[model samples]
Structures are given as structure tokens and as C-alpha cells.
Target: VTQRLCNQIAGKLNSRPRKRLGFFTPQEYIHAHL
Candidate 1:
């Protein structure tokens, strides 16, 4: 895969809410912690 594709995938994954995080996206969780 190209670098651009990898970034797109990462962005999508990070923007998705996970049940383990109380339905918060990864980005939201990181910002809250930081």
C-alpha cells in the first residue's frame, strides 16, 4: 500500500468509536487523556 493509503486507513480507524473506550473515538480518548 502507498503512504497515502496507510494514512487514510489510520484516520478511519482512529475516527471510529470503540466499545472499550466507552464509545469514544481513539482521537477523542487521546485528547481527553492528554
Candidate 2:
């Protein structure tokens, strides 16, 4: 249950694009920075 919920949150954070990130998802933003 805890693991499942954490997976859901991680999925959203990795997949959702943000305006503050110039419309890039968290994963993309991290790669772009590095």
C-alpha cells in the first residue's frame, strides 16, 4: 500500500510537465540541467 502510493506519486512527478520548467517534465528538466 505504501509502496503503491509512492509509485503513483513518483509517476506523476516524472511525467507531468510544469510551467516553471518551461513545460518539461521533472525527468527532462533534470537531464537538461545536467
Candidate 3:
């Protein structure tokens, strides 16, 4: 159970940057915007 929870949390963290940029990776969006 703990391992499953950790995996879910890790996945969320890994995807957070993309979500923050409206589904674009943060670096990709920033470069495009600039």
C-alpha cells in the first residue's frame, strides 16, 4: 500500500510541471512564450 501511494505521489510530482504550463512542459512553454 505504501509503495503504491509513493508511486502515485511521484507520478503527480513528475507531471506537475506540465500541468502548470497547461499541458506543455515548463521549459517548452517558456521557450515558446519567449
- Candidate 1, poorest ten consecutive residues by summed lDDT: 22-31
The per-residue C-alpha lDDT of model 2 at residue 8 equals 97
In the range 1-34, model 3's lDDT, one tens digit per residue, is: 6999999988777656676688876566878899
Select the stronger candidate by TM-score from 1 and 2: 1
Q: What is the lDDT of residue 29 in candidate 3?
A: 82
Question: Sorted by lDDT, highest first, which candidate order results?
Answer: 1, 2, 3
Give the runs in model 1 whose Cα sits over 4 Å from its true position. none
Which scores higher on lDDT, 1 or 3? 1
Q: Model 3: how large is the Cα RMSD against the reference? A: 4.8
Each model's TM-score? 0.79, 0.66, 0.46
lDDT of 2: 0.92
**Pairs that collide, model 3:** none
Please write out the lDDT profile of model 2 over residues 1-34, one tens digit for every residue: 6999999988988799999999999889999999
The local distance difference test score of each candidate is 0.94, 0.92, 0.76
Best candidate, TM-score: 1
- Model 3 residue 9 lDDT score: 86
